[model samples]
Target: MGCCNAVRLNKCDEYPTQYRTDFIRTGYRPLPFSFKECIKSAFYANNETGNIWTHFIPFLFMVHRAYNVINQFEDLTDPINFGYYVHSIGVTYVLIASTIAHTFCSHSELCFRKCYSVDRAAIIMQGCSVQLVFELYICPPSCYVAEGMGRNSHVILTLYCVLSTIMFCSSVHPRLGRFQRFLATLPFGIGSIMINFSCAVRYLYSSNAIESTCFGTTKGDHVLFYFHLTSACLAIFFYVTKLPERWYPEKFDIVGSSHQIFHIFVAISLYFQNRLIEHVTAEAKFKIETGELLREPLASACSQTVGIFLLTFITVHSVVALYYWKVQPTIQICKPPEKKE
Candidate 1:
């Protein structure tokens, strides 16, 4: 009772391993908090407060933005604008799903796993939805001339499915922890870059799309590749290093934590992502109306959405369900960490 008397306990020091998200984070709610308490804690200034609000605020913003997107077309099912709606729905769903996962993760292992699985699955769909629209309207001139419904397009789609599968499996594996999950994100990151590459190149460099109105109405529109790259880099740094909290866990426990920083940058990245979608959508619409765009638009965009739904459903639910059936009941709590002399 000597040194321990002055120190509050870390839940990870005693709880089952799956409940732990970060070794440096010390403000976890007790392992069996009820759903009501977990929801209530979102209001309290706990470690997850920032995580919850970052995604939740973005979710609300995107919901508003999606409503405006709906008004862009008279028919809800117009194929030309329909992919935009799919993208909007996917983004908003992931944001809200992230909010829910962070909010209720303390409820129980089952709830935690289920919520996070849903969040991860939503993210997969979001990536697919984004790349689908980009392929339809945001890709450059060469995309039409070289890969117009060609082999590269199918290759990209297959690559996404494969990488997403790796990410999903590593994410839910009982033996894999944060660091392994971080490694898993390498593949996830590759898939994400593939999703954004067509649009990102326009922001990063001169392109036929950029010279024309379909790309933009102004020169040097954003140079947003640097902006998003910085955000993603910062996010990865915090996620891997665990930052200032890694050095002084208690000082940053309730605030100034690395996860909070990570969440802030993630929200920023997604907000700008949606903005780019709106920007490119407007430009594409203008071109379509004026007959500037050649090559039929959205030949496979809707079909890809269906394939994405199937892939995500298979990989995501299988990972979660297999965890429940195989991993959950078998894992055991570990002995608390020992104090240094």
Candidate 2:
């Protein structure tokens, strides 16, 4: 039923076959697809349901975080707090858009592909957007054109933004087919390289200063930092090579799958990155607002943030993998034919 209708009936229950037929006749149609597509479609729906809700529900948690951060600004001593507001809004918008797109994507193939592309773009955009807090902390907007030492952070941030743009664009047009996914790999590969370079520059130029600024700093922070770097490398590698699982084929479909592992690792990397960024930013914020830097006595809050994200990421993906395993048929692995040997 549409607007102005007296009764809005659920089509799947009320008309079933006719509902689908009417939808197609009205130009809202799914893909002209094979059995393989049917399997993919069902699995996509299942995965979308879980993935959207898992990430979407966290918006409440984010709102709480935002509230706390805003409250932290009650003191006039705090540096400009405007940046975080925009950051929070951007994060919330991405989550909301992602959830809505995924939920309704199954309406049609055109819808599905467009929504999936938007979904992927949201992932990339969120990663890039979150980095801004760090940029703002290390160097305020005024320092963007600053000369000498203060300029390093600004330069690195520009590079980071450029790479993120590339990633978002690649997802927007991941080519036309299997071969097209390869094109998508290029931007992520480049982004990975640029990020590593940025990390190195950050550490080499500003390590002690940054360390003195953040709270609850520890050796593990460095460990997790490298872990994030390694995962980024692995994400790029897997995107390009499609290894292990590709080598073994359908054997790893349900659990112990490469893509699933990649997703989990990506989430883990983001967790670490967020912690590190928060630390770095807090340090920078102290420096800009006052001549001195102060560290939070307890980084328990940051740790909790990381922990919740990891738990949610793993639990959601595990459920999705299980659902796909039980509902999907065993796919026969196919390799591109070798030259007529």
Candidate 3:
């Protein structure tokens, strides 16, 4: 079994060269193609060790945060408040998927690709969940046209999911070059920007359209929102550029690599998002307690929207898996022959 200790250290060229990427410059060791071996690697150390722990540690934090968020809510019946709980679940899913993808990706190319799919799906789900929470809180039924906003939110969620699915499929398509894969993933970031812009517009419009205190009262909220936006952008930039590592490759293989930096930025962004969700939850609860806001029953429209998203997610994964399996034989033939140990 490969490990990261000095005795077991493996340079970039020492591993199966087929798995090498510009980002995974060096200090990587190939793991035996076994689930048990992969799990053991997590403790021994390896190139993927850092990547795994970065997300895994944060995954633990997210679990704790999710629990706290759920406990804070007095009523799980209100959809608006319940949205935060759902958001927590989505975030936790993303973190855990990321951890698993990174930890065991070295086990085999096939495992890596499948895990990548899960990671991408989880990320898209997280983004959509965040958008849903924002739309619900920023343009609550008290301030906006309840029926119209509900429908709009549903439509937006469906469209975003479709776009995300397309992006994920294109990114992993065996035919795509490196540049093309990068381009394929760009839509996820761009879509997020578009959603934020729309939410900002809704906030402004809602403020002008009604005399409700439910929207945009906190200066800190705006600050955290922009901070998160910046963090997200930075994370994407580091990921795309493969910076620092690109400047001086192997030196960062074990630490301070661009991928590690990207993971840190992502964690920071999620922290800000959690804070924002907490702020919104507090506001909603206060309103409910003060009799300024009435607790609305969970909207059937919201349930339908979630169901549509789930269906789309499943369909997309199924199609991608089918395509992979269909072409996998050809892919194996084209790959370089494995060397005998």
Which candidate's TM-score is highest? 3
Model 2's C-alpha root-mean-square deviation from the true structure amounts to: 14.2
The number of clashing residue pairs in each candidate reads 0, 0, 0
Each model's C-alpha lDDT?
A: 0.65, 0.44, 0.67
Segments of candidate 1 deviating more than 4 angstroms? 1-12, 23-25, 140-159, 177-179, 198-226, 304-341
For residue 23, give model 3's deviation from the true position in Å.
4.2
Q: In order, what is each prediction's RMSD in angstroms?
A: 5.1, 14.2, 4.0
- Position 339, candidate 3: lDDT: 59
Q: Model 2's lDDT to the true fold?
A: 0.44
Tens-digit lDDT track for model 3 on 1-45?
334343354565556544665666555545444677678777765
TM-score of 1: 0.79
**TM-scores, one per candidate:** 0.79, 0.52, 0.82
Name the lDDT value of residue 196 in candidate 3: 71
Candidate structures ordered by TM-score, highest first = 3, 1, 2
lDDT of 2 by residue, 7-26 (tens): 22222223223112111112
